[model samples]
Target: MTERRMVAAIDTSLVATAAAAFSVLCASTSFAGVLADSRWVFPALLVVVVVAALGVLGRRLHWPLYATASTQVAGVLVVLSSQFAEHAVLGLLPGPAAISELGELLSGAADVVRTGVPPVPAEPALQALVCLGLGLVAIVVDLVVVGLRSPAVSGLLLLCVFAIPASLSDTMLPWWTFVAGGVGFAVLLASGGQHRRWRRHEDREQVTRALFGPTSTAVAGTAGVIALLTGVVFTGVGTEGRLPGSVPEQFGGTDGIGLQPFTSLRGQLNRDKEVELFRVRGLKEPTYLRALTLRKFDPERGWELEGLTQGVEANAQLPLPEGTDIGEGDAQRVEIQPIGYRDPWLPVFGVPRFLSGMGVNWRYDPASGIVFTQTNQESRPYVQQLVVPKPTPEQLRDARGPMRVAPEYLDTTGIPPQVTDLAQRLTADAGTEFDKAVALNRYFTDPSNGFRYDLQTAPAGGGDALSEFLFRGKRGFCEQYASSMAALLRAVGIPSRVAIGFTAGYRQGDERVITTEDAHAWVEAYFPGWGWQTFDPTPLSDGRSALPQYLNSELHPAQQPSSAPDPAQPSTPPTDGSTPGGGPQDDQGARPAPVDPRETEQSNPWPIAIGVLVLALALLAAPAVVREVRRRQRVRAISGGAAGSAGLAWQEVLDEFRDRGAQPAATDTARQVATKLLEHHALDESGAKAMRALVVAVEREWYSANGRSDESLPETLRTVLDSLRRASPLDLRSRAFPRSVLQLLRPQP
Candidate 1:
């Protein structure tokens, strides 16, 4: 009868543990706001179910805790490996190659974590990560609840799962997640009582009735409601001063839409208004007015502007270019007047030799030829004396090769494999870097490649966006063309960067008027002797595109007429800007020009840091802290003369002995256990006397009818605890992480 009861008790605890773990896993579905869809949730759920099923099977087979845990972990690894990287493994089991492939997927997931915003794409890598993370959590939770019979200790593990989406999301998690967790915790607490009573040989009928009783259900329901309300109040109050806690719900919808420098440009081109931005004077032919240069490229965000690392405050005459040789038709004096335009970057015609009519607030980066100011230049028109390097076709073709430049310009780190392969194949026969660059430009501009200049394609996400644009969609405005060609140039070992500005608008009276519709993005490749030469890959039929004379000489016939858009035609002009309606704009529909993609939206790192810290503390400090708290509560109960005080003190002594590597058998009397501990550690007279006193008090409280509480039990218990601790290792590992506490935190099979 006793053996049967013990078996039954283990089965009851296993069921409770599995139920609690699954409930917490369901609450994790709040990640739907952070991921693109609910597909990831299914994989995470499978992980928890596998762990729970293995636990049941392990109990039936009478396997040790470690064997059960090991089997569950192996099962999870095999399932994920088969699902994600089956080719890498030799058979059903995971090998090093499979692990490496899974690691690469995790690296991809890290990239998405860094560069992507909320509703990030649910790629294979992220799905695998979700599976691995939740699966391990389920294993730890099962061990803590069933192996150690400490269901309350599992709360910390469940909180970590809840924290993932809560920390990453730009909005509040769905309320149902909290409710599910609260109800699960309540069930865990109720079932734990029943498990404990059944193990103590209580009547089976009474234990079952207590667990499933009407009063128990009502109490659990009330506790769950209280927990949910308390959690909401604390969570909302704690993060209120931080970012998303204060952000409105509507703002979160645009988070991971991959806003680029050209999305705004597309919106501007679509607007019906022909708002005049700038009026320019002084050029014999139309040329692009340079505003800002985007030197860094992100596979997801596209070309992004970066802060000026080295530059001087703008003055009358800026330093001249060092290695660039000025061609015959290089120098020109240009005057730019901003009318409706409002931007921080000043638009200049070419390589600036001298700049005037701007204050000290304007700074110029010499290497990039970008002029920026603290405030909008709408009221501050400037003049630039320029040396626009119009290298001839003969000169460009004879240039040695790509020159050594900043690593950022040559960075092709995250470019898609397909893009790199395509670039290599296209440039195979080319002799010089200039020829390779020209081939890439021609590839985009060639109508046979099926590239079209359309502004209607929806934005794409993930690192494969460039591949889609080049081989699949084949249609986008200047943003796609310039960004793709730049990526291609970098892949072929030619240092390349993107320039965002406006093309010289049509002639209006004596001055050329630049409108919001003329915003454009084009590629500039570094040539050995010629410096950075312009390459426009966008196939524009609207006449706003201005190809450099050198590119036209090399890529087109001498008498092609440049295919200018008719002056009378109401054609759409190309623009390179960021997301519209995302920020403040003027009446002309121009938002402040977007900064580098890195600077577009600065996220606060504190929430992520805090979440990480909390998880670490939970893992490293939770066991120690919980153990200390329970010890103090028992000590206080003895001091206050509470009923069952002597039994609580006796339990504390046994726990202390267990922590010090001593285990007393259940059949041993209190005196026998005390005598064995006294002899095993060779305790001094003081420790021996305290152990004898505790043994006496426990026996008196249990066997005597009076059931007297002993006032000296707390001090006696402390004396016995100190003696055991002193004989132990005397290190942080011994005190902070005692074996008794570790059994509750460590994962069992």
Candidate 2:
């Protein structure tokens, strides 16, 4: 094949390889969907394959680069339009109708990105957007790598393809996907340089070489290294979100809700320092202040927040708790002041009878008794009248199970098999659903079970974290215990869900201070007539008390209230007090704070592994890079005189031959080198003639005062070098790398 055609072929292959790699990278976004099936994989592959086939056909037909690129782009648009036929104008290309459809799909995708967490199920619109976006990326990559002949910029375009999914994702892309993408980008650059070299030679032969040279191989090589390194870093790091102490300014109630409620629990648990959430006064006894309830459970997704009630005016009366008697409970009044705690839901101790000192945008969910605002509200003092019910064990035992409760409450289809088995085993001896719940609660609270309450330990299991905690590690804080118990209760035909809020803070006189450290989670099991009763499965430790007196069989004497204080009157003498930091003061007597598990400083071997790989690659390629640099510098230094430059070029060609094992002695003259080339038959007749011309030019430059100014000497030398390179059996690196220069640079004895 002619050198020009060979270079074009190489460029075409490079573009195809890069497009394929980018398609694979785009597939990483599939994991962001709830379904295991990837919607974009096939469509992305189709786009790349079609573009490559058309590009090859165009090259064979000797079409202009612009024409080929335009054809490829049009092919992509046609394929996409055909793929989404319903939206296409003629069912083959994007028209006005298709444009409208694309806009709608993009809008839907935006909504999903704004409100939903990662691993969301792939809706049709989202899948369409994925296909269209990847198709466009493929076209752009083709233009940059093959048409424009700028493979380094093509690497940046590939980076854009990879970045889209990586930035939006909550987890790292798979390591293998990253590896494939990086390799593809590197290959693209390497191949492009090889093709460019062939094109330069071809152009020189045609006397049509441009003044501006092609980009250096060094530039392409450097870009490839940097692109691969970027991929490694992105795949190694996890995306950050709401954990214990990392609560964002707009906690909730925004159009864009980045963190799920369960993730918020995790964030709270992972917090290292203490910040006050809120403060409360006039409470007759300690209790957990309810914030929000997560009702939908998915085995793979954990807990999901769905179907939340829309906001209502602040003055709207809140719904009473299911199965609870409003008239029979003790009426208590309390004042709450928010500090750092920022959630749409207002923290309340019990069923709120009335709320005061709140904005009109505040809304309430009567079913869950959660008070929230439409927009993020500033922490303001609020008064609440709550009806606190003290349900007896006897009453709970008499209540019915799934048969009597709402069907929605009994949904346990998402529970894993392991959780079901563990639940049955733990509650086998119990006689009733209520008894089974109690048994499950006791199983978690018992100190003899070897379960340790830890915040830093990762929850075990692939997607079934509850099963892992129950059967394996048996370690976690409030979230684990509460979520596990809820799942267990539902498994045994009982209705249950998890509630998140804060534990009653340290009582300094009459007021209590709640800190971020006080963030807690617990289960609420539903009964036929008794309503959803609070169950604390988290074991009390580090000066923390156990389950409330009503839930535990052997209640501590100190936990019992001194008197039945009137709900309408002050329960105790109000004492003027506040937390030192406007939040809960860190008690020196409390258990040592657990380390934040997600802290980046924790030991991880990925960065080390990437570093080693990069170092090893750099070491392997250093010789070739150094040789190339030195060769360029030497040529530039001798360029002042044409004869001298030609002589230097001839000498470099001899060194290349020597390096390839056709060892011409150091004392050999240019005439002797040409004789050796002819005797070995290393070149064709024309190449042999060129070699002789090079030798004659070098002799004039070396031996004559006014040497022949052979402007064509450089071209003649290059042709000779190319011929010798083809004749030698040695690999490209052994023949082309200037190792002889290194020997000359060495200090000899």
Candidate 3:
């Protein structure tokens, strides 16, 4: 009867300790991140599995504490593996083009994880590797406790059991993760006494030993290689978005409703490579592309707009520094273009002067050559001025020493050999890296290759996608062309990344309407001090890459004077060549039908107000939650059940023993009040055993502290009183407890 009671007490204490730990964990986890790119129902169902596992262990199936914990832990690992398969794991590529290709392929698999449906990314190679390596490692560690019977090993396993919650999801609420996490925590609580002793075990070792064999290793290696190589292909896809100066030419939008439900811009972004939405002509030196500054990175799969903390320096608003060498340049006009893309972000060259005729939120970053808009840049064109320097080719090349990479950029973008090989092949005869880089770009971008500007492509070949492009499918897009070039280059060892943008200005009249159709992707190579230089290797685009070309009614009259000139004439206005929208030709002067500021001001304020109000209401409801929580706790205590002061002490001891999160050390057990007399807090073997004795008493007799209720509390108190008779009280006892509970004090060692 005593042994049965002791076992029940241990189990109860574990449950109690887990509950407390679980509360802390839930408070810290973020469920939204997991549900963002994925469907909440998958993980919700997974959590349900854990709850069900717990329920079964308690009721019908009655699994041991270890069995319940192991099952839940396994489920969490599966969820995490599915999560990694979705987004982040592929983001480790070195370049944009590589990343895009891999991302698309994996995104297909992510579809399954999202819906909790079967048939995950079934590239047979990846599936065999899914559960063999790191997955096996986790199971082995868990088995070290279960099969090998080592408590120390078990504690380590339990500590690591939360890996999924920590690393996989963005901000998984520690609470939900604790559902599985509590099992390991429960196991840790029971890893003392003879129960914790190491013993020889077999079943788990059989699996571990099998996994270490050759077949599993090869499977793991293939998966890694594939992910790494494919990541290299799609690296540039993540950067696909609207640039400055692009106008709405069939661009996507909410059409005045809510977020994308069907045919939305949210997921359909990065469909094709054409980043350039604006253009800054006559800029001094080539600058970096600056998009929206990410305020906070949601670990799940998106970027949230944090407050605009980064802006012009406060000091800059004051008198300029003496040695700063800050100089104002001539005012240059920019012709903004709108692309058919869906994001609100607009790309631009040089610094943005201001959003002149815009009805959208926009920001400028001079450090990188970019302009960002709040809505799809393809729908509207905003005119602006820029301050820049126009440098000659020689000046740009010789102005500085050899190439240099920014210190901050080194860790993220290390050069690979494959890129270098392609660079060498492209620029074999060039004098310098810059000359070679530019020459290679020029060669590939030459007119003969038929690199026409077309969004559509003719499908070709078998399962081999890249093969179709390089050989059979000659006609291709920027993404195809860039990835092909980037892969061959990475094979050689060039520090290169895929670049996406516009070719040049598409002139309207005085200004340009850079269309979404003009979006393009190229290759960028780091040239030491020169930094990342853009290289467009697409053929037909190179023909019109420089300056604005006016599609005049009268083509160069010298080349062809009459409107009735031959079809093969170099430049002539044909009767069939009338401009599409009969609107008057436009240039950089005053724009027609300007943005009506009155309409912008007249926009209904209620929608934005309602959004703010909803957010406010959620925040206001917090206090009521706290009050309700306290009331329940109070009622439980007054019920004369297991949660009174005595029960509370018992609970505290169980928690104190677990020592999770941040806490002081566990110095004494209930029986050894005198021996420790502040002898260091560390417990020796004898002290440990003595503490274990007290644990048995509080656990079975006062099991409520361990998250279970006990009806025998009054009888347990009498039994505790009898035990106290045999113990001697110590000076420390007088100070730690209340004077009213003198009889409740335990005898010291």
Candidate 4:
């Protein structure tokens, strides 16, 4: 092959390599449904880019294939070491210490994989695994595209990333992610060049190239169609509304709802818009709705439900919670209508005694306080005759524990030392378990304790995230408060479990509308005589958050009422007494004064506003900027008077045609492309003359034995471009977002 032809081949391979890398990156976006945030995306993206860059550099240096692949691995190791490993040889190399730390992170990630639910926390270990996995995928894609020159085979490797979350999680992958992967695959196929073939006739002195060559058009088109069909499938197909690891159909709601109950709870609260999940009628008083009770707690994994248990049918009469007497609590009637919540687990106000209007698929596990079904509960509406226990402070203080509850509730095997120390210190003066529970709840709600309600907490660092929330970082949402408080209660020998559900939402009209924003987590401690008592340690700023009457010291001992509403009185709307800032308020609607002047001062908004505006404008102009830069680079190349100047000039014309949304077939020859451009744009005599001359120059550069430079080729290309621009003036949208630059984002014609 000639020198110019060799350079063109290298350029085509490099473009294909870049497209392969992009395909993997696009496929990685599907993990958003699996992980909590997009934190893993950045590390995955960084490692892929590093791998592609090293592959390109190795190709340019003409290294052996093994040497190039090895270099790519080394580059990934260096990146992983910098991101996750603590110590390195020179801060850039992966040493023994770095490798050891990497092994530890991988081990932790394995544990996460086994126990974590969808939308699991994006910890350091998970992020490190993402980087390493994507880096390996990038290396494979690079090798297949650049070394073997087969872009189609590399797509199969990219499919592994897309298929992982789809097969693992019960939730469907987002539709746009599939579209992105399709577009990337299409670009890969388009960049793979057509092969050339020559035939010589005995009668003729000069050899003639074939009129048409095989191209990747059919393969790319098939891939594009498949991607579109997959996107439609993702949108049109409906899931059965079952979460991963749900209980078997025989036993109602078993251990299927495993560890990481807090993951879904936190995800629901972090949504940008609040969606109403349920509407409850005849709720006599405000109370927290219970969906599922988590009895098992692991310091590394947080709260979880217990193992499988035999359950009874939920449509008939139900037994009271374990260790509870028949007539110890007040009986109340309420009706709950499911709205947007589609999970299998059903929501109830309190311990259910008699349930009506439930199907056979629904089962009740009385021991764990959970009612679940084999199918979705979106259209299911049920009535409950449940009982709410009311206990006074004096009774709780005097009642002694019989210790009849499950051992799982009191198991403190994984409780951290910090939690034990804090619990002991806070409850040392208290004489009874009830007093110690009150002290712990008071410590969480106290403003002096530096605990505040913030959805966006400090970024998770190494070590235990719960410990960090308890001692170093005190600001967090409901899950943090509830989990930390439950851990502390367990550390102090009080049998406690975390309850996952919603708060008493504000009344809309006759019914209480509970939205995703009302989703809350609280500590439910099991007292031997009283059974279970509800306590919310989260310092919610809203007035809807009310403590039980027993926890309220302001109420008289004899006048204390049940937390559940009375069956005799009419239901009324709760009062709205939220403060300006998210500060806790008393029952009388009074907020505590700010302790620091800085807390009272408001932050300026101008800087962030200006920065956002600037970023928006830049993004809007990105296509035009990139197109202009590419044109300048090609024009400079033509001006250099090199051997491939004619090829560069022809590429400029092709880009102009692409900008006008004209896609010529890959089989079109140089002269054929010039003819198409001339006829489509209806150029004048001067432009036509320039176009014909440039085509001849390109043909000569490709076919001639002694290839000569065309000094006037740059000027000729510019003349043709000016004529085309004048004949078909681009609209503002077309110019700013040029098709030439954005064609890779959509399917080709």
Q: What's the lDDT of the predicted structure labeled candidate 1? A: 0.67
> Please, what are the lDDT tens digits per residue for candidate 3 over residues 1-749?
11111110122222222332332233123222222222233333333333333433432255665675566455544444343333424433224443344355455434322221111112212222222222333444433433344434443443332332233232222343444334333333333223333221112233232334454455445544543343333222222221112223222221211211111111221222222345443332223232332212122222222232222321111221111122344455554545443344455443345545545445443323334444333346545555443333453345344324322222222223344454566667755445554555554444444333223334534534444454455455555555455444443434454544544434333334443334455554444333444454554312224321111111222433222212232221112211111111135422122122223323757533653575466446534443333334333442466433333334333322222111222444433432342133444444444445444545444434364444543444333323332342224433233232222222111
Winner of 1 and 2 under TM-score: 2
lDDT of 4: 0.71
RMSD of each: 19.5, 15.0, 23.7, 9.7
Model 2: per-residue Cα lDDT over 1-749, one tens digit each? 11101000012343434544454354334344222235445555666667766775676577987888788888877766765546686666889877666666677565454433344444445566676666666666666666666767766666676776565454555555555565566555554544555432122212111211244244434544665567557644423311222223333332223335655564454343456677788877667788887776777656655445554454656566655543346688899988775555677886777888866677776655677765534547899888777766676677654344346566897788888888899989988776787788878755566666666445334546666788787877777778888888888988887888877766655677777656788888877656677887776443333254457653223545522222344333212221111111134523333334434323566533654575567667767765664456445534545324654666566556656656555455557757876677458766788888877776676677787667676567667767766666567767345455445421110
3 or 4, which is superior by lDDT?
Answer: 4
lDDT winner: 4
Please provide TM-scores, in order, for all candidate models, with all chains considered together.
Answer: 0.46, 0.49, 0.31, 0.67
lDDT (C-alpha, whole model) for all candidates:
0.67, 0.60, 0.35, 0.71
Error of 3 at 169 (Å): 27
Q: Rank the candidates by TM-score, best first.
A: 4, 2, 1, 3
At residue 483, give the lDDT of candidate 2.
82
Worst 10 residues of 1 by lDDT: 1-10
Model 1 agreement with the true structure over 666-726: per-residue lDDT tens digits: 5666777788888888777787888899878877776787877777787888887777666
